[model samples]
Target chain A: MEALVRPKLQEAYEAVKRALECVHFCILIANCEVKYWGRASSKLGRGQRVIMLKQDGSVLVHRPYGYEPVNWQPPGSRLSAELKDGKLVVRAVRLRPWEELVVEVYEVHLLAHCKLRDDARFEMYGSEGDIRDLLANNPELIEKGLKRVEVERKVEGGSIDILFIDERGRLVVVEVKRGTAGAEAVIQLKKYVERLKGELGRDVRGILVAEDLARGVRGLLVREGLEFKKIDLRKLFEVSKEQGASLTHWLTRC
Target chain B: MEALVRPKLQEAYEAVKRALECVHFCILIANCEVKYWGRASSKLGRGQRVIMLKQDGSVLVHRPYGYEPVNWQPPGSRLSAELKDGKLVVRAVRLRPWEELVVEVYEVHLLAHCKLRDDARFEMYGSEGDIRDLLANNPELIEKGLKRVEVERKVEGGSIDILFIDERGRLVVVEVKRGTAGAEAVIQLKKYVERLKGELGRDVRGILVAEDLARGVRGLLVREGLEFKKIDLRKLFEVSKEQGASLTHWLTRC
Candidate 1:
């Protein structure tokens, strides 16, 4: 790892170029103007931002505020940096889509680079898939007399999250969302119901199952003749924990 | 600025704690396990991740592969670092939403911190507002005989981007998107057209203007009886540049 504090423009440029060549993750705190041309063209005027060039060829330019990067290039980009006209210019380009991001640095406050090793897989709970699995196992969580027919039933265009039969024997098509269910979720559920109604020639009901509904989505769901069910993720997580604990206890006893 | 390479766990923890107290942006490259509980709960196993703690109290954990932070806390979070049980633990908490993110570091490869000064505003072109402005000024870009009625017409729920009168003398409601128009965009345009139809008691045509269309959005637009117009952003940018050049020339002569 190499760290240079308040480095000269030329010195920072040399270090950045060397880091890129060595396939190291580099961080540069600089005042820079950024220009990006790819799917869309945008130019950000000069500002102090943190520029991160990852070993896997991902580039992120983050402003002082906000979680999202002001400018970014995904993984598998080609990166190069040089000193041009007394300033440092770093460019990242992708071949297939031909996207390019250019950062012209006027001053460098700090520059650091190091090789990172990360191989552990990410384990996430309370995702959309987890919610779907819980609902599949416990259909009563959705409704009292609902019975799960199939989970992830494939249709023509996409797959239905869960297909259930209500007490009235009507087919219910479910769409699961981990976050807020928006107008798009309602449209998706409506589409699934329409497709199932045509294929099965039966009365199909669409239900959008999510943690919460976005503003104005309830009216949209009502207009589409679909239903919205709020799932408490905390409760779901507790139930899942209990199930896991019981399973572990049974295994130990066996 | 301070940089420590392959320092002792205790030494790194003390430096991180001091940086937090001094209101500095701190970076720690370490093998860590992260747990976040907030809008949702997620756990990332022990891996080498880049942890950025900004002076504004924002925290980001990057896993080296993607542009997005695997775990993040927005600005205004309360941050603290400590050493416990032969490991370093960093915590960030938000009060309003009652969210917390904890990163337990097993090994620190690199640790750096610096006070960053940034107060520059971000200026960008070819955003949604930019597209709307261009379409409002030059309705011919959308269609030959289209005339703009209003740029942002306020409705009950939200504001329409652009409202135009087509050659057929029908009301056209335009929803401008900087990126690809997805199913949600189509649904939004449909809602706008419906609202305008009710208010005007006239035939309203819904047109979704975007740089591209997401998969299956074209079919959704068709089913919703809406129109899709692909705007070439590069051409729009060229026209904008020419306008700017002419405007600058006019100013200089004046």
Candidate 2:
């Protein structure tokens, strides 16, 4: 099995599926591509958006990462980043909904170190904020509550990882995992959101973040009006070193 | 939900399916009681054996062992030992064939300042071997073999903590990990077994001596045929304190 494609399929699944509906998509799993239609979901052919993101130094995974080259191959998904106006612009997705009804959501902390060099392109979380600032200045991002926030909301007995919030003080709960964004993660997030609404009134909302979540996750997200986000360490480092922007300035701008 | 169950399942699975399959029978899993079915394979429950041995402090596991209470829950498994005659007559289940297939095997060596203490009833791992004895006893366990033995056996691994020769003349592997044992211990032992097989062929046998092992690992062992006999660490300490038993008597007892 190709070790590369599994994560990508997981990302797509996270993007497309609803929490309860995800079990249908994940009946049989091999890497990112799941066993649907009685066949293994192989890698997406060229120009595909689902590409597995492999981790190196400074990443964490609670479970072993799964990849298969024999049956499935990750679709070649590339993000295009171009500074539009003053804010970073991206056509990619963020954490999504309906998926939270199944699995656990981790509180992700952005841990980074800076290494500056000459001219290069850059990004923050693949988009939105500038990578340069993330590397050079993090407090600016953290204090603005743009990158991290503390969430106090319950689901059944478990709590949610708040990803983003709005003026109404509503939460965007997110679940981050390093391996395949599974059906469980989708379902878990959904339940979390539902419970959050009951606990914190109807103003609560949520998202799911991962190295790559599955298609089922996405299906759920789209229907539930949630978001899906993937961050690549390789691309993240590349952007931080090359992009021309002050870390604090870029974070503050976002 | 109970932490003890997962590791025990993993252990019971391996010990039955592989290690002592020719001798013991294995049965019972999770919370399910064994009911006679014509199709069932093993007839005994090694889970009790494992739980019993762990209590004796001859084999170590988690501290505060046993299942958690759920409302007005029933009491979990407990081990109480009674020694009769010269041989330790433990009231425990013999490892069943199917059960042998499940408990994952490990080889380890404890390295510290004392001998095993069965009396440390609640200590996750028992007392250690004496520091002086450990220093003095080192040379004999790891006595260098002839050049041909070294050349033919390829003993160029593991920066020698302690060594012993099993019946097959294979270098026995040992390790002492600080804190507790979990999946990492099982994985490390498996790696060592593979290394010995790959590097020394039929010349190396693995032995694990540690303070404790995780309860969940047995589930992983049942099918892999991972074998390493359990060390009665308490006996080791007893032997150290007594200093009267001959090597033949000592080795046979363990």
Candidate 3:
């Protein structure tokens, strides 16, 4: 039985291995044979194997270490209030009441916005071909929309450097500059959000993508009912290059 | 000099604060004193002042802690082409590749060879007002020669959802799933990339929009060449609401 399933899983594992720039760890096919399967990445090494799987209504399982949820996310504060940073803070962004503006001077800037890998290092691929090959092997992941658009898109009073919506429908309106988010972007995205909601409608969320987001600005957005996502363009481009490699593979193979 | 510039910056900041949820983050004003910015959620106690200004741009400004980078990034492998878990392991997904793929998948999807982003969360907002509103805020995105053709987008097998292309100078094909980015999306986007590249140019980019993203699938896309992003439908509605609040503020003053 071990021999039969091991071959198929091994084939899948190899397919994954052949297409990546980095490999953290790999779990054993046996471990994944049971239901609810997963393993610690640190333990993956030569000759070691572990995974979780299930068969026929069974909750069979295997985990080198027990699996339990660690970082708990409270339901994001009621979606009605303004988010200061990534957290829920202000009761709301006051759709009907403009408050008196009396505050000190500060600068916030929005930089590049792109989907980052869960494995930070996974985005460090050095070549585009490598990234493209990885995509060709995946049984899932419909791979048609894989291009990155970077343009100086200008509007009535401003210009957005990179305006994109990611694979998961998140509208990431990135405003990049020489400085960090604290310098000019945070405010810029904030303003963009205000104008967008006004012209777009009252149900759109925006991300203030930047290099280093100031804590205060993060708080302001979370409390103000906005979502904040961060990324460094250098790292993102590196990751994109790998994706390019994967695309190249598909272009050649198919 | 400080006082004079402070008010303008403050007004800009206030304008920004009110504009963020509306998607106004841009670069036109980045050269101003404020260069970049984002939103921070703050738990304020009315009179409890938060340190919102940066002294030297290097200091970690507080108020809203900068939006935290997503937690849980998988680690990296140390060996070269090592075998583990009954399978052969080689490089990491985020590093430079030894050999890469070169296929452009965007063209294929647009040509009906790949899938799109219409899953569970893609349809969550279900209102034209919401979808149109979301796209409207991104005014800077070019849509001249691009086509806004509606088609039956293939999400997960058997789940064909509504899809559209906001054709400007560059075609921005959007796949709206009901929920998030899963392993299946890798295949969906790959097809799109190939089709778009084939039909348009290698430069065509695809956007797979959903509400959530599974970690493995996201890593797979990074390893591949396709792009996918996550969006919270509830939060988007909130952004629109915040804009309403800003108008209310102006109205109250009048």
Candidates' interface RMSDs, in order?
16.4, 30.4, 23.4
The TM-score obtained by chain A of candidate 3 when compared with the true chain A: 0.35
Which 10-residue window in model 1 chain B sums to the lowest lDDT? B245-254
lDDT of 2 by residue, B1-254 (tens): 00112243334334333322232111111221111111112122211111112211111111011110000100111212222232122222222111111121221111101111111111112323332233224222222220111212233444323445533345665433433445665566566667766765765543344444567665664334444223333233333322332222211122
What is the DockQ (computed on Cα atoms) for candidate 2?
A: 0.01
Candidate closer to the true structure by DockQ (higher is better), 1 or 3 = 1
Q: Write the per-residue lDDT of candidate 1 for residues A1-254, one digit (tens) a residue.
A: 79887799989988998898899989888889899876447788777778999988989988765555778777888999888887899999987657789999999877888787788765555668878988887675676557789999999889999999886689999899987888888988998999999998989998898878999889989999999877766556544433432322111111
Individual DockQ of the candidates? Answer: 0.19, 0.01, 0.02
RMSD of each: 16.1, 30.9, 25.6
What is the per-residue lDDT of model 3 for residues B1-254, given as tens digits with 9 covering 90 to 100? 01111123334333333322232211111111110111111111111001111111111111111111111111221112222343222121223332211111110000000011111111122443344445345211222223444445443333222234442344455555555567776667666656656755646556666666777777777776555545545434333433433332111111
What is the Å distance of residue B241 in model 2 from its true position? 75
lDDT (Cα, tens digit) per residue for candidate 3, span A77-170? 1111122332211110111222111111011111111111121121221222222232223201212222233344565578655545444444
DockQ of 3: 0.02
Query: What TM-score does the first chain of candidate 2 have?
Result: 0.36
Ten consecutive residues with minimal summed lDDT in candidate 1 chain A? A245-254
lDDT by residue (tens digit), candidate 1, B91-204: 999877577899999998888887766666544446688789877876656765577899899987888999998766899999999877888898888999999999989999
When 2 and 3 are scored with TM-score, the better candidate is 3
Lowest lDDT block of 10, candidate 2 chain A: A57-66
